[model samples]
Target chain A: MTLEIQNASARAGGREIVHNLDLALAAGEIVAVVGPNGAGKSTLLKLACGLMPLHGGEIRFDGSKIGSLSAGELSRRRALLPQECPMRARFTALELVLMGTAISGQGRPMAERVAIAQDTLDRVGLSSFMERDIMTLSGGERQRVHLARVLAQLEAAARNGAPGCLLLDEPLSAQDMARQRLILQIAKMHAAHGGSVLLVLHDLNWAAACADRIVVMHQGRIQSHGLPRDILTSELLHDVFGIPDGCIHQHCSTGRPFVVPHDLVMPEDINKRETPCILQ
Target chain B: MRAMRVHAGWILLSLLPLLILVMLVAVEVGASGAGIGTLLHAPDVATRNLAWMVIAHIRAPRVVLAAMAGAALGAAGATMQGLFRNPLADPGLIGVSSGAALAASCVIVLGVDMAQSGFLNGWAVPLAGMLGSFLVTLLLYVFATRAGITSVTTVLLAGVAFGAFSGALTGILIFRANDTALRDLTFWTLGSFSGANWERIGLLSPFLVLAGVIATRLAVPLNAMLLGEADAALMGYPVERTKRLAMLGVAASVGPVVAFVGAIGFVGVVVPHLVRLVTGPDHRLVLPGSALLGAILLTAADTIARLVAAPAELPVGIITAALGTPVFVWLLSRIHGADIPS
Candidate 1:
């Protein structure tokens, strides 16, 4: 099944934070949406997940309007692991993962669901911290637990060939190098199992290395959408990012994307002085 | 081998009966000394009847209502604290109880004589009181909830505004009331169970039980809520609706308690925190635990309030404030230095 956003937009405080934008995701595909700050990448994901009200446009899954689905039904299809997930209640690593399975399997025996949760924890490499409180875990560890919860959500949703999709808003913001790779690797597994993923990432190289496709966002609009090699060029990067063609990547044994500042080209020269810029 | 000793299972087992004990004891004992023996005696005996009448009819109703009030306030306080994500929040200080107080006060001060003169008997009082509480709470809730969710700051602000409006009206009514009425109104504002009777008790029992059941049922939902709405929602919770239902339940339950029992200050704010410390943020534990703890604290306070003056009486709210505030402060300090409620 495919998850699609049809002209989805979000208005906060009567101003459109995310204007009308359309996108779609195919099974086993991980798409990274990269944008400058305030580009509405996060809002788009929220709108699709029904976390935010539909200010305008419609979100659909497998050609069905998302608004038509029940809250429980919608949750069973896709899960979102939000960026700022500092919990008001700190659950144990196992308990946090248990929550993901709990929602879909609410009718099942509690012990049964709990057993599934333990398995998910083991899969996420958090079996050792199952009983450890979330507070004791460092930032990277918490992210793993959250990602584990997302995996459990999908696992519960995997009944009767249900669509398993994950929408992550900067899932790796506060993590170290190892944790970042670990999260993306888990996401890739979720996709390989016929799930779809829409990731909002600031790190272009990480996105390039992980995502099958990349979408570039600018000021609440999508500037370009294509394969990583097709879109992560010097021109698009400099124009949308104003990166001065400086180093963002380095030679990597891991075959990861890295940038080196070959020359410090000005935005004016890059854009051919066509667009008026206020930024210095 | 260790599978035999689950701490949570044992705690739940112990706590369930403790909840029942608090409820039964609070309703059984009173000025009549209707404790273990008296509660079980035959109603035909004169002393038994007198004790029964006093216990079941007089103090029992009041104590039952007090427990209901305490539970609702505690539940509401817990929900509001979660909503605002602030542990220090109190509905009275933030002004929800005052708003209800204002609404109820308007009925007590103004509607009393008119309803009596109409020969409607006491029905009009509760009706008017209920109307006042419902209207003010509804208005305040509406005012506070702008976006889908109700923030603590907005709810607190709206409560303050609504409370001030109600308080000012209460002042006006007090000024207009006759000397006896003014004196009576003073007791009502401070909160007392003196007027409690079986009819009032019977009338209130359903609301209390219904609300309490629903509130207790919210333990799991509330446990999920501690993760905050968005994360909870993504984890398969309907975020906005969960919040709305909780708010409605708290308001509907607590507004009446405030109306009946003046502002029983700090029971809501104090009990939940204490329950959380003992049981952690698992609402399955905290909600029921808070209900029992609130009932125990309020009933004890009410008993002490009665005993302290012996033949005279003190407002239960004062006793609760006098005792609860210090205990609450101690709890705050103990939970301190640890942030984010682990």
Candidate 2:
């Protein structure tokens, strides 16, 4: 396994936020943690990234206890993109991305760091925003800049021969449809390159489509953990998310699961329709 | 949109000539009216002695001391703002100046006679001031930080409260002091470069250079911290160590200056901001730019303070606050109303 969390629990503000969670991610695998808001999805990602200390369990990376490694060691091993991009400084997108390499000790010349930053920005569809002040960018654009920063960190680590893990919290919440797909594709590509990914996503269909394994969390506990094709049944969705039956459908063309909230329609309106128009 | 490519090195290089020009001008236009040329080419030994006294003993030290103090405060301000991740955070916001002033007042009021002591006479006041500032900073940080994250708002509020608390104590010290000590205390509190001499400058250099160099080195970590403490740690930047180092650097930079020159206002709060306007938000650029610009500004401000009232001389703090307020207000207005979190 590339990353392992054995019975990890964490508390925030005098309350336990993550409780007795055991999960592991192997190399070249994408694991998505899906849950409602405040269900400890973000907390789990943060704990795994070592941003928060675990109260009652051991976190290991490459079979060594996480707490034993120095901060630089841990940082060179994993990159996290937090939920809120709270960067309000007047840094250009390129400058912001270059800051990611700070943990790697700035041994590379400025030109090389700039080249790496620019390359990641290009991958995130922000090649044109290299010089633009981050403050001037829209929320979505700023999120992409942070995404590019994480990607740059991972790439730098990979070049050093450590295929690090990427822990992202809602990495695509602000993007449009095309960019969302692009972000997932980027995550998949990272995993395919011998890296590991633990993504916190809210959209169930996106999880089902992108994640090799889905871990559903509720009230700070994992409710289900398995392949999406087997675990993401109608009963689990209804129990975990309050989705009624006939709402989730396996796409005929793609053969992947998708959610259609057909239960929201009024009974009289549904009866008036000869056939449902959503699938058509 | 294309990124704006600002050559920070070239900008720093360009600032050198301007700073030197200001320093030279400041050295010339003192109340003594002894120009550098006349001082250099005195005809008689007696005249040369007098000229040297004015140039070396009076003018040069004042200018150099002002430069050192201003540069220290400005760099400290920039580092503090970056460390706290708040644009409005200043070195004085954490009560360093007030604490130093309080200690110095205690020494003066209590008749410590630092200048007349056996071995520590020359160094007593500055040492006490440095200790005072360091203690307050340590206490404030202890009370304000929790679980590695420092809430910027808490630090600011604590600074204000502690400043007022120390100011009140200083006021009590002043009330009990005799006429001689009172005059000295009043002048010191108003903040002037009046007693500048090579001795005080020598006393300040080690701390100034140490803090300045450390803060400049911290530019990258400070930028990492701009993303927030947690993110900075996750990025491999040593968050706790950076915080401790930046805090120590601020105290070391500001403490000795407050001990020697009293509380020179606004240079700490204003120069870094003006530097950022030119150098962008990169602390690497901002720190060095703040240092040079700060020295230049204080030198110029001291010159103006000496000449504007001519021989009577206004306090340098009065001049900095008078000039800094308007600029600070203009900066505030430039930000959109929505930018101020409602």
Candidate 3:
């Protein structure tokens, strides 16, 4: 396994946030973690990346313990993209992307770093934003810019023969449909190029479509884990997510699973008592 | 968008000649009618010799002191703003100046002439000022952060409280000071460069130069920090180390200037923001650009302070604060109205 989490647990604010989660990833594969809100998807990613302290068990990267590696060494092998990055300074997209070379420690010259940043931006479909200020970019564009930065970091790490793992927490939440597809294609390309990806995705359809395997989480525990085609069945959806009936369907041409959620009406009794604030 | 359009490196290079020209003009504008032309070639040997004496002994040290102090404050201001990711994060605004001033005032009020006496081996005043600023900064760090995330509003408010508290203590010291010490205290609080002898300059240059170099080298990490501390750490930066460097740089840079020059205002508050508006917010540009502009701004302000009242001069701090307050107000309104990050 290029990345391994063995019986790990994480706590925040004196509450067990992620309990007894074990997952492993090999090179050249994409794994999507799908779950409802507050299911500890983000917490798991944080714990795995060592951003948060693990309360129990252990995590290893390339057979070395995560606790044993320094932040620089760990960053060289893996990169994480949080859901949102707050930017106050007016760094251009190029300068911001070039910051990915920070941990990799200046082996390449300035020109090479710039070129890699530009190439990564182009791959993420932000070719024209290289000189534009990051603050001027839209929400979706900024997300793609950070995506470019992560890809550039992983690419540089791969050159050193280090394990390359990308951990993204809700990276596509702010992206549009087309940009979401582009981001997925980029993730798949990374996996195809011998990198491992573990991304938290809220949309089950996208997760089912792009992930080689899916791990469904509920209330800080893994509910199910298997091939998407087998695990994303109507019964599993009903049992895990409480979505009943023919809400899930297989595409006629590609045989990929998708969700429609046609019967999403609130129950009459539940609406009177619990739905005081309806989501508009 | 148009405000930050200039290329910072080109702008800095272009401003260098102008800064030198301004400094040359400033050195000649004084009570003594010794101009640079007179210093170079005068009609008589005696006149030329007097001009050389004026240039070498008095004007040169004063100009050098202004430039060095300005550069230190400017770069320190830029570092603070970048570290906090707030446009209003100036060393003066964040209790550094008042803290240092209070420490110096205590030393003076107690009649401890450490520069002459063997109390701290002639290093008591500057060392005390530096220690005071460091402690206040540590207090600020503790008060303004919750769960490793910094709250800019909390920091600003805490700074205001700390400044007020320090001001009250300084007022008590002033009330207790003797007449001779009172005269010194009054001038020091208002700020001046009259103490800019070669010896003081020699004592202060190493600290200023060290701080400037460290701040300039921190450009890359400060840029990362602008993306927020958590994001900077995720990008493989040692965020704690960067924060420590920034805080220490602020103390080392501000303490000596405050100690020697007596709490010059507005330059630290204004220079970095103006430089940012001109250079965009990239620290690679902001840090160096601020240093250059700061040197220019202070030298000009000091020159005005010298010449505006003939033989009697205005305090340079009053000049800077007079010039800086309106611009600061404009900046406040612009940031508030536009919801720009402060």
- Candidate of highest lDDT: 2
What are the lDDT figures for the candidates, one per model? 0.73, 0.83, 0.81
lDDT of 1: 0.73
Candidate 3, CAPRI quality class derived from DockQ? acceptable
Give lDDT tens digits, candidate 2, residues B1-342: 222325656777688899889888988887767778777787877777877788888998999999898888888888888876666778887778888988888888885675457787756666778889989988888888897766656877899999999989998998899997898788778788987899889878999888977886698888888777878888888777777788789888888888888888878777887877667777878888888888888889889999999889988888888998998888777764633110
Candidates 1 and 2 compared by DockQ, better number: 2
Candidate 3 stretches greater than 4 Å from native: A160-163, A264-280, B1-6, B40-49, B93-95, B112-127, B134-161, B333-336, B339-342
Is 1 or 2 the stronger prediction by lDDT? 2
Tens-place lDDT per residue, model 3, A1-280, is 2889999998888889889999999888899999888989998898888888889999998899998988778777788999888776667888788898767645777777788889999999999888888878998899889988988877766664644899999989898899899999998888888789999998999999999999999989988898888888888778777888687778777787888885665677555664463221
Alpha carbon lDDT at B75, candidate 3: 87
lDDT of 2 at B242: 79
- TM per candidate comes to 0.86, 0.94, 0.90
**Candidate 3: lDDT of B341?**
34
Query: Per-prediction DockQ, in order?
Result: 0.40, 0.57, 0.41
Cα lDDT of model 3 by residue, B1-342, tens digit? 323455556887887887898788888878888988997879899999999888888898999899888888888888877776666678865567877878878887884666457757545666677677767877887887787655656767888888999999999998999997788788888788887879889988788877877786688888887777777777788777777677778777887788788888777768887876677777777788888899999999999999999798888989999998998898776667553332
Arrange candidates, best lDDT first.
2, 3, 1
Worst 10 residues of 2 chain B by lDDT: B333-342
DockQ agreement of candidate 2 with the native complex: 0.57
Model 2: CA > 4 A from native: A160-162, A267-280, B1-8, B112-124, B142-155, B336-342
Question: How well does candidate 1 score on lDDT at residue A38?
Answer: 82
